[model samples]
Target: MQHESASAMAGHARQHYQETEQEHISRSQSGFPDFEKDMPSLVNRFSFSLKDNLSSYLGSKNPFYSNVDPQKDYVWLLDNTAYQNRIGRWKAEIVAAYFVKNSGKDLSEVVGYIADKIGMAKDEKVEETIEQRIQPLLDSILPAHAVTIDLQGVDVRLGPSGRDGISTDEIAIPGHGYKDDQVITSQAVKADATTMRTHFASPKGWAVLSDIDDTIKKTLTASPIGILKTTFADEPEPIRGMPELYKHIVQKLDSPPFFYLSASPYNLYPFLRDFRETYYPSGTMILRDASWMNLAGFLSNLTQGTEAYKVDRIEKVHTWFPKRKFICIGDSTQTDPESYGEIYRRHPKWIGAIFIRKVTGVAEMDESTKNDPERFKKAFDDVPRNVWHVFEDPNELYTKVDALVQTAT
Candidate 1:
């Protein structure tokens, strides 16, 4: 029975991973230049045969891999980069699958191991060590950027609702009432884009609100149980350039963009803190609620709640930054695109631009997502404009963000 449960868990996990890949791919606007028409041929060129053998190592334990006694010499095999690479690649594949599946638990330390071993993310400590080494050197040369300037204080505040018209429950869902061409702009969107400004005493300040699962870091292996399993195994791979991306934002922030970390729930703040301490190293976080889970069972029976939670968060964001311009980053694996689109529609004035990491899968709309697809579509369709900026890799986003910052400056 134990083995059966574990096997069942593995199957569920694999499906989730594949779905994540699909959803991520779907939201992507660009990749491989002209490869879309030839995706089948392209995929055929990869070593997919590896999956048959890879599956066993990913889930089953061997005496060799379990032989380790200490945390420091955490090598699965001594002096065998090939074995390490194979394991890393396999782990990366599974974790990436997990991200889309949302199958895992919350074992931070183990997740950290899979993340590091698989190169899911760079060691957070490395960034701190480098910063400590480089701070004095950069401080000495700071005058090169401008006149003698001392980095001073920074403050950020989340604003409240500007104009309250309809009550939260006043919003209506589709099919149940409204027409095919029906619109709910009255209750959902602001009269115009909400206006919020991130004022800087200096020349530039920038903020980034990144998605947690697959964007900045990888806990993508899903399942709270899988997360628990991999906790002691290996570190998940970090999407390449994450550290540099955060660093660039930090460098730009000397002009002091009032940064705010906004995400779907308050629980995700620790991941953001990990980002800050390791890479950006400084910023403020605008926390949001995850209370939707409390109503998950109830909401799953109805379509109203999907948009309700997202709408609630956006309204909170607008209230907090009534006049601040901020950059938004989230994945397509969840409600990010629609959420950002609605925010852009209501307060086009406040949102500078949105960068959505397209992690693929419309789980919300999938039968497997445990929600009403029709309801999900209605909420998505109601958004004023498509606010998604999809990219295949972190590097693509870094290039675009560089341009946005330059233009903003």
Candidate 2:
């Protein structure tokens, strides 16, 4: 875990940033606006004034407040999964995000907004105090472009970040004789820069592709206000029995690699990453790429075009691990069933089992429709009923998971 000094890392990042700025300048001199390089800044500038005014008028430091410091920023390297390619080389996709620290303000304004949206805003000091505790969740994203990060302890060099302040690159690890599920962490070659862990998964074996909202954590995605409360106001709560069920999955599946795929945007990576570390097996989280500027985008990220987004990400995973049998797990609150079904149809043999949680009892949701077997049946149409199971409880999957192991044996 040894890393370069903070000064060294910061210098490297600055060099890259300058080089990228030069390129943007050249492009702009050619008579183009360089919109890709400038739009994020414009949006951030506008949003800052708007949020500041709103916060001032309301006299509250809200979750949506955007106070960015261009001079100070940090890199966040997301956890990734590596696999051995056909040429006997280990390869992994490195994803990183850049951001600046936000003003450490009470996020009670988020709770207040949610309360007002649902007509629940009141003088309940107890509830307000509870929501303020999650203030750490609010971080100002650095809308940086072309920021490069060097790595230590691995053979990977991430490309320059895009307009959204995220960079993704696929690099081949130069070594052999690595253990299966070997965990390798790449530290930033600078001080205080984020480090990422890559799990080396063998080319063949079992892997779990699970969802985040409502599958393992209580996200309440069916209701917009519930979504906001759980995401911004309240502490993340794991669905009952899911932590144990995931542990059982690890034991029965022989500690296979897990991929927690979600439709949530990448800004929530740290928050979701903490939740995963607390209750589930360590896995690479595949999240949406959009770095949204407003609170509305959060809800839209969960509900809009999610089926297509999940399908596309799963396809990328399939490309990386074509031989591995996958167990797909998701909930009924959104498009998990449809997304999983679409992938399963395309590669029937690649997927071994599909589990869909029959989400129910959440406020403001059409529970009867969500829990109806007909919906699952329609969603899984053209797929084998024996291959997919819908359940209300995590305990119901223990024997089913054991059965998959036996079938594989």
Steric overlap count per candidate: 50, 2
lDDT per residue (tens digit) for residues 312-343 in model 2: 89999999999999999999876788889999
Best by TM-score: 2
Q: Cα lDDT of all candidates, in order?
A: 0.34, 0.68
Which stretches of candidate 1 lie above 4 Å from their native place?
1-206, 222-224, 227-237, 252-272, 286-311, 360-387, 406-409
> Model 1: per-residue lDDT, tens digit, 1-409?
1122243245334433433333343223222123222211111111112232233233222221111112211110000000012112210000000000111222233234334433544666643343332221111000000011011121211111011100011111112322211112111011111112112121123444554445565544333223322322334355566667666655653423333334323333344445544644344444432212111211111112233345565565444345445677665445566666677678766666676654544222332331344433543464433333556566775556666665453
Q: List the pairs of residues colliding in candidate 2.
A: 6-191, 9-190
- For model 1, the local distance difference test gives 0.34
